[model samples]
Target chain A: MIDEKELVIALKSQNECERAFQILVNLYKERLYWHIRKIVLNHEDTDDILQNTFIKIYKNIHKFEEKSKLYTWMYRIATNESITFLNKKAKKKNITIEEVKNQLIENLESDIYFEGNQIQILFQKAINTLPQKQQLVFNMKYFEDHTYENLSEILETSVGGLKSSYHIAVKKITAYIKLNETI
Target chain B: MKRRENIDKFKVPTNYFDEFENHLLNKINEEVLPKNIGFKTPTGYFNKLDFNIKRKNNSRLKEGKLIPVVSKKTFMYAASIAAMVLLVFSVLKDATRVYTLEEIEISSIENFINEGNIQLKQHEISILFTDEILNNITSNQSRLSGNQLENYLLENINDLNALLPY
Candidate 1:
């Protein structure tokens, strides 16, 4: 396993930066890709956002204060990039971001990369109904299995807030599923 | 008997125990949503990603130092001022000179249209000409016969529809 501290040091060094970046890509590309994919719901858009996130990370490595874990900082960047992308799409189409996400969920049926069955699609539809923060909280906590502390760092929310958001999100999702179960 | 009754008298918070079963059930039901969201990437996408990112980074590095420091707005303001100065100089050089429609090139008119500076509504355009002149222009401009117009519309109906306001 590549030590994150050593990687960060090498990334900061002039000669070793490029090699370290390559290692960074190899290490976190899949994790970041999935994290973004859950938010965006489209493979191609997720891929583009992931690339932009990496580019931003590469350019701003010197500004990384190391106050947070490197992964969490990178996750924050990826999350912001994904949200920015969705906001841009919403602006271009003159729709709300929720509408954009709903459209994405609708398109999931036809996406070749989406292997979800009917119930899975319904679950995504339920998640789409949630407020953006709760959706993120639930996805990270329930799907990615992130701890409250790690989530607090990445989301910039307090641990108490994250826990409350996750709790509400879970309750809402459970109600949605139960209500729609007959369908 | 008195001690057993007092021990049994301990009470719980209102609705706490009542809601506990429902909350627990909801927690269990939360698992009904599948963990696998069924997203998959194309084969070899990750393998190719690093190379793509490297190429992009290298290209950016090569082009970074060559970027002009001046913003586009600054260049546009400079161009506008230069054009105004030239116009003033030409008018001073010839006080009574008048230019005909032919003096303005068609490409210049096209460029002006493409620049999006002409935002006149239909009624505003109509207001520019008197009724007689408008009638004359409409009567004189029969370049496309009805058949040709219909054919053109048939070929580009979608494009024409897209250009409509509503």
Candidate 2:
């Protein structure tokens, strides 16, 4: 594991910034990729957003305040970038954001990159039914195993709020799955 | 049998089982849901990711540097050219503009006449013309032949008195 402090120091320094950036990318790319993929649900878009997230990180590393963990900070950037991307997409397509998400879920059926079976696909559709914040909280908490505190830091929500969000998300998802399971 | 009945019954909290069904159902649902979302990337995507990002970063840096250097001069040059084009366009626009009689609003003409800017008396107007021009105006053998004069009179019967050199 790279020492985050040293890596940050090197990133802020002109002489070592490039080398440290490579380490940063190598260390966080897959994690960020997965985090972004869960949000956007398409590999190509995830890839584009991942690249943009890294570019943003590289550009803004100097402004990193270190109040949060480096990973969480990066996670925040990835999350915001993904949401912005989706909003732009929705705006471009003249659809609501929810409709865009539903469209994405529908496209997943034909997506070559989606290896999920019918159940998994249905699971994703259920997740798609969630409010955006709940979806984020659920994915990060359930799939990524992020602690409420970490989610709070990444999502800028109170820990208590994140906990409640996750709890409600789990219940809703469970109910959705059960309701749809018969079909 | 009395001794067996006297044995402490397995004490259960009231309503414990009430929520158990829901709890168990939740657990089952959790277990049944797929752990993986089944999203996959292209082969070797991770291996190439860092490299591609670095390449992009380098290109971005190069572009950042190149823009200021090129744009400072280019912008000034462009601005100058655009200003010149605009100046030339405005000058040409004003120079070549033809105003139709309808375009000269009656109100503006009324304003000009009311302002005494063009209140030349008939005698002053006649003085402004040379004798040669005055002869041309009154001459029967001038540019407007008899036929043209008759045609003008026929076409503008109401304005015939205005057409006379009064």
What TM-score against the true fold does each predicted structure earn? 0.65, 0.65
Q: Per-prediction DockQ, in order?
A: 0.23, 0.21
Ten contiguous residues minimizing lDDT sum, candidate 2 chain A: A160-169
Kindly give the stretch of ten consecutive residues in candidate 1 chain A with the minimal lDDT sum. Answer: A83-92
lDDT of 1 by residue, B41-60 (tens): 99999999999888877787
lDDT assessment of candidate 1: 0.84
- Name model 1 segments beyond 4 Å from true: B1-26, B67-166
Report how closely model 2 matches the true complex, as a DockQ value.
0.21
lDDT of 2 by residue, A1-183 (tens): 678899989999999988888888888888889999999999999998899789888887877878888888788778877877776677678787889988898898899999888888889888988999999998888888888778887788998688667667778887888899897
Fnat for every candidate: 0.58, 0.58
Q: Candidate 2's error at A105, in angstroms?
A: 1.0
| Cα lDDT listed for each candidate | 0.84, 0.82
